[model samples]
Target: MMIRFSKMQGAGNDFVVIDAIGQAIDVEQVDWRQVADRHFGVGADQVLVVQRPQDPGNDFRYRIFNADGAEVEQCGNGARCFVRFVHEQGLSAKRKIAVETLAGLIEPELLDDGMVMVNMGRPDFHTRDLGFVDWQQARARGQADIDDGIERIQLASPAPEYLPSLELDLMSMGNPHAVLFLDAPPNDDLVEHLGPFICTHPIFPKQVNVGFAYLASPNQLQLRVFERGAGETLACGTGACAAAVLALARNKAREGLQVQARGGNLWVEWAGGQSPVMMTGPAHTVFEGLIVLPTR
Candidate 1:
């Protein structure tokens, strides 16, 4: 079967967005990995399938699949692209849209400036929320601590003597994340070496996205992320949010922070405790076409 899809990007993260709502798609029969393959098919960091909302209260529902074909809970960049996609496709006329994801409800609004802003729900620092294990032992070893209701932990570096141990703030933004604040920008080699190590760490049962962040100033952050299934990408929306929220909580940065990813820039805002994080960024349409679903 052939499917119509839009090639979209937010910041630098790219996606193959399929309008499942308008097409009869047998999602199970499609080879997601093939569609996301850089060389063999439509290359993308993830595939976004837009469908009609399962709940009456929501305007739409969407699912995210990584390049490796694993379905994930949340995706901030894709959310922006989602809103743009629906509007361009004539699926929705409202400037603000309420969508359902595996993570939960998220609201995305289109601004007059042509940028999209997403309400990424409250950040959760509970270990249980992140499915983090060995909490008791980590705390006993003085590698973990709680300050201002936020959990911070120290992870031994793989190259201890040569590299400094990483102090990470763990949180769940619908998905798990480990943010490491660094004194300077991290090199590609360092991110390549350490990102997977922390992402697949045994402590994170469901795995985690690892963000290496440098606070450029009180309101500017530079970041790189190794995503759980997609490896490294040009940008990661949720990673940006995770980094900004953690920085705000720790007083390392103030609200309305600008996060610079390799691909582009995203603006994040938070009102301290229990408030939803707002992420603003641009979503672009690269192209659109039809591709046949692989039977095997």
Candidate 2:
């Protein structure tokens, strides 16, 4: 069957948007590897499927799947693209609309210039759930020490980061992440080089998003994350949340700070030291087209 989709971007983080409303398409049927095939399929950093709201008092419901087809919660870049897609396609008339995601319900406000700002709920944390074994195992496998009250998982990797030298903050916002603070902005080559290394590290049972942060001030930060399935994306919502939390812990930045990602800038805020984290950013529509589903 031929399915119509919209190709959109938020700060360079691209996605394939689909409307499953009144359609019998089983979104889960598209496997991770298949959806990420650039030659045989619609290529994108992630895939977003629009559907009827699962909750009352919401404008719509949408789900995010990484290029590898792993369903995740809350994509900052994708969220921005989502609202723009809906507006462009005449799905909603309101500029401010409430939508539900795997992470939770969020309100996205569309700007006049076509940028989107979303109220990404908060950051989540769990040392164990982020898929790390105990401290000793991570130290041995990842070649790092787990001090400073930060819980971590050190999944094995073919070539891992210098764990002992780097400080990583672990968290989840419906997905898992590991954030590292760097002295300077890593070159694009360095980012591409180490991102996958940390993502596949032995300590993270579920390959984790690896974020490298450059702290500019107590109120400003620049970050780039190698998303688990998507590789080094322009921006990452969960990674931003984790970076904000980690920055606060190290006193590098305060809550309600500005974070610059590869895609663009995001405003991240934290209330309680260990409470939910907030992420805000933009979304844009690039074009719309049709894709024929490949038979399995």
Candidate 3:
């Protein structure tokens, strides 16, 4: 079978988007790991399968699979690319459309400047949802609040190369993330060295995306994220949203913040607590191609 696909990128977080809605493809039967392979298949941070919405009011159903073939709850960058993909393909005429995801309905809008704005939904700060033990103490003494917060936690490190009991600000932006605020500028070495430990830490039972964030200014921040299954990509949309919420909660950043990732910059705005985080970035189509799949 020849599967048609579109290669898209939002802030350098790329995806191989397949139009299952139009093609009538049974996406569940497809081997995503083989399709996401960089050397042997279409390379991407994740694979997006666009299908008709289950709900009558929604425009589409967005399904996400990481490079490792695990289906995740949500993806901000992919959401942007999703809207762009549908619009370019004439799937929907509306500039602003709602798409259903594992986390819930996410609305993404296509702006006049060719940028995509997504309402990433409200972030969850409660420790229970974030897989943390104590909500009150963890929030109060989060690493953002104390200098030696990393030493406060008694959790053992998952690896010997990493430090034990690293303090992190946990949150759920459709997906779980552990934000580690750093005093100095972040580097690739740090993300590569400490990211794996933090990502697989026993604290996060479902695992977590580890974000290394640095407050550059009141409204500008630098971030690098090690995604759950994709490793460290050039950009991570949900990571930006999670980082923005954490930065604002810790008073490190203001409402409108620019999150500079390794690939590009994304604008994240939050109106404090219980409000959806707005993320604005660009999505581009790299190319389109067809892949031949074996009949299993």
Candidate 4:
């Protein structure tokens, strides 16, 4: 069968958007790895499938699959592309669209500036569900004594050359994240080298997305994320939100922060954990095409 999909990108995080509302397609059964292959298939950081909302109040259901074929709970950058794809395809008429995700219900609004803004729910600070383990405390007080929420802890890389211990702030933005503050810009060599180690660190039982962030200004941040399944992408929306929220928690900056990634920039504003993190960024439709399903 030929599957029609739209290639869309939000802040350089690209996805192949498929509308499965009326189709007989079993999204879960599709070969995500092939679909996200850079040379053999339609390369993208993730795949977004649109379906009828399971929740009556929502307009649609959003599902995300990583390039490695794992279905994740949420994707902030893909969420923005989702709204843009649906709106452009006439699937939804409203500028503000409510979507049901594995994490929960989220709202994405199409802004007048041709950018999509997403209500990224609230940051999860008190839950160990995101796989933030305090190895320091675990070693001293035993694993049973460790608790949840953000804490500064020393994390040693598995690499022999990079033996320096790093201090990272662990948090979740509908997904797991490990944030490392840097004194200088996140260059390609440093980020690509240490990102995977931090992602698969023993502390994060479910693995994690590693964000190398620097405070560019009072209201701006420079960030580069080594995504768990997708490696180093040009941008990561949830990463941006997580980094900003971490900065906010430490009183490093106020609300309305700008995060600059390699591919582009994202605007993030948050009032704290009680309020949803708002992320605004550009979503562009690169092209549209049909892909024939490879026989298994």
Best by TM-score: 1
Best by lDDT: 1
Off by over 4 Å in 4: 129-137, 140-149, 158-163
Q: Any idea what lDDT model 4 has?
A: 0.84
- Per-residue C-alpha lDDT of model 1 across residues 198-229, encoded as one tens digit per residue: 89887667778999999999989999999998
lDDT scores in order: 0.90, 0.73, 0.84, 0.84
Each candidate's clash count: 0, 16, 0, 0
The lDDT, on a scale of 0 to 1, for candidate 1 is 0.90
Q: Looking at model 2, report the run of 10 residues with the lowest lDDT sum.
A: 155-164
RMSD of each: 1.6, 3.3, 3.9, 2.6
Clashing residue pairs for model 1: none
lDDT of 4 by residue, 127-155 (tens): 45445564555457333322234655566
TM-score of each: 0.95, 0.84, 0.90, 0.93
Q: 35-138, model 3: which lDDT tens digit per residue?
A: 88899888999999999899988889999999988899999999999999999988999999999999999999999998999998988775464444344544
Ranking by TM-score: 1, 4, 3, 2
In angstroms, how far off is 31's CA in candidate 4? 0.7
* 81: Cα error in model 1, Å: 0.4
Candidate 2 residues 132-160, lDDT tens each? Answer: 43455656566544455566443333334
Clashes by residue pair, model 4: none
